[model samples]
Target: MKPLDDQQQACRDWFEGLRTRICDEFEAIEREAGSGASFEFIPWERTDEDGTPGGGGVRGQMAGKIFEKVGVNVSTVGGRFSEEFAASIPGAEDDPSFFATGISLVAHMANPHVPAVHMNTRFLCTTKRWFGGGADLNPPIPYADDTADFHAAMRAACDAHDPEHYPRFSKWADDYFYIPHRKVHRGVGGIFYDHLDSEGEAWDANFAFTRDVGRAFLDIFPAIVRRRMAMPFTDADKARQLEWRGRYAEFNLVYDRGTLFGLKTGGNIDAILMSLPPVATWA
Candidate 1:
């Protein structure tokens, strides 16, 4: 898609910048957190139905001997939103017009104590483009302090741009991250919202908000890692971690609209599935 508007360009640039910052920050954090860690960025190309070139993304994987796995991925996909694609996702049945562009990202941490997190910040245009995406946590084992810390960091980020954002989106995260059958949350929630328009002053404010959250990830997650990474995990803890991972895979495969949308749109399979843990046991 042509970069026709300022907001679209800004969103693109922001994602580029975030990709760099996250990779660098994670490397440093991994070193401080423990040993036997390594990260590699995977490059991907986006193509049209006829194999015509479109766009691409960067996928990064960080694995440690101490921890199971960690991955962070960023992608920019633009083109027509097909009906077939819309039908794949749970709520995206409307099948908007032919023009869509945005960045989607997800981060999964290896340590069961650290929690897995996902975020997709994008500026998508149908009739007109709009911004969406937020960060949320999914912990295998609940730690109230860590949960509180994660939320507080997210709240602070939102508050920097708009004070009203924290409470509104916090509740949104809580509602979105819930698993009905289990009667439990995927994790202590952070924030989730979509369909933000770049009209009035809202666009500028939201851009700032998005940037704040993007930067906040580096600050919030590593601290949790430092606290939990070296802590001894028993066989039972490992078993539970794998069980929780199964739940994670279920949510992404069954419930997450983003995963469905990506897969249906012919997104990079490896990058899309980066949210899955490196090692998981169903039973």
Candidate 2:
């Protein structure tokens, strides 16, 4: 309703800053693997349905020897939601206006041995405001140690905020990232959370928790990538990855809330769809 508050502006800035840090780290990983691949950031504008100008974002993408394809995006957009969508978003039943800012990332590893990954964190306002997002590891060739370490990092991030956070959010991820038709869970679940209301003084604590999640992803995922990046894989391994990718694609296109939000808000098409893998096989 009023001009963006100090806290709201801070959230937007933080998301943008996180995007830069992540892109830099990923590029460094590319270099370590003897690939010169670097992210190319493309900027786009958002326009509201009634022709008012909304904020925009940059989409960062790279393909390299280790990472087959990766996309990192930071977006800050505000405008009215459509009547159909407004009813579903909390606090938007009466006022269709909304504000959202966050960072989202998805990486598809070139080597099948190196697991693919996804992570995101966001803050949204619609009369009511809240924070949400998470990370997960998806490996075609599952490694027990890799899964354990990934979950441990996420649990540490959660435990720092609240003792109940790890168990609650971890289960939330398992439930949220499921493929009903195939009766399979998507990846080795990490953490998924949403609708964490930031009321009054509670905003600071919630924001801090969200930041820790991002920090955990930054610190842990690259370590995992480097661990298996050099491992050799056979033709069968590659085939399994391709098949798994098809399932990943299905979830993003059909069940992902972020994808729907971006499309509804006039966000960049390529950036919104960046979660989809570069290549996949149905069978």
Candidate 3:
């Protein structure tokens, strides 16, 4: 196994910590909500560009009677970001030199009332370095309180790092997560910021902000789920869930940079695609 690079090591450490924290919090939330939620951590391994260097990480799944399914996957894809990665986005074609420390995560909730969430943070280093990641919500049945609570939790998390961050990133998310064809948002927007630089102390601040949001996830998600998990669902709600999932499929396959990056970098296929929900319906 080739030695992990500095950035790769950092990503591995941070995600390991995050995995433990999230699982513990999930367990606590399940107990309190009286939901029989339990999770399974699946250990996985993969090779680098040449299949010479190897690395491994954990993927987790949580499901219950009340909740359909929730998946959390963490992996490090180390090597030059593949040509496929660059090709996925039209403008990225000219970029030649590429090296990246990739970390991606997403949570899918079973209840239409609660909403599904996705987040990915990565450090891509060429001659320059930057951070990118954001969290967004996808509620099946939109309710004012649920949307407000979800956004408020995210806003508080961002504001803790910098007050200006909330509006700036929230707008970015709204724009980034939109579906032009559908003429609707993937969900009520949260925070999305990308390409944060290391110059003038912004690097430190950006990571600090990212860490704060990550830590805040444990608190934010369960609160929303607790309130909505027991709510009654009708066939209509189920139909909407399937309809919205089609939009999600479009975004992940056509637009998600992380998904593209993972595929390009020779990452594990199952791990890279784990962001997809267990079940989805079109139209």
The most accurate candidate by lDDT is: 2
Write candidate 3's Cα lDDT for 1-283 as tens digits: 4466665477567766877777777667677767667888887776766555545556777876544666677765444445656554333466634445544566666667778877666665555667778777788777788778778878888888778889999999999988787787888877888877754477667767777777666677777777887788788888888788888878888887677666666667877787787788884
Clashing pairs in 2: none
RMSD of candidate 2 to the truth, in angstroms, is: 1.1
lDDT of each: 0.72, 0.93, 0.71
Which candidate achieves the best TM-score against the true structure? 2
| Model 1 lDDT tens row, 1-283 | 4444666666777887877776676677667755546678888887866565656677777776434566667666666556666554333466444334454555555656667677677666555555777888778888999889988899899888778888888898888777777777787789887776667687787778778888887788777767887777778877788898887777777777677767766788988787776666676
Candidate 3 lDDT trough over 10 residues, lowest sum: 88-97
Q: Is 1 or 2 the stronger prediction by lDDT?
A: 2
Candidate 1 residue pairs that clash? 125-129
Model 3 / residue 32 / CA error / Å? 4.5
**Per-residue lDDT of 1-283 in model 2, one digit per residue for the tens?**
2367898899988888888888899899999988899999999888888888888889999999888899999988899999998999999999999999999999999999999999999999999999999999999899999999999999999999899999999999999999998899889999999999999989999999999999999999989998999999999999999999999999999999989989987899999999999999995
Candidate ranking under TM-score, highest first, comes to 2, 1, 3
In model 2, the runs with Cα more than 4 Å from the true position are 1-3
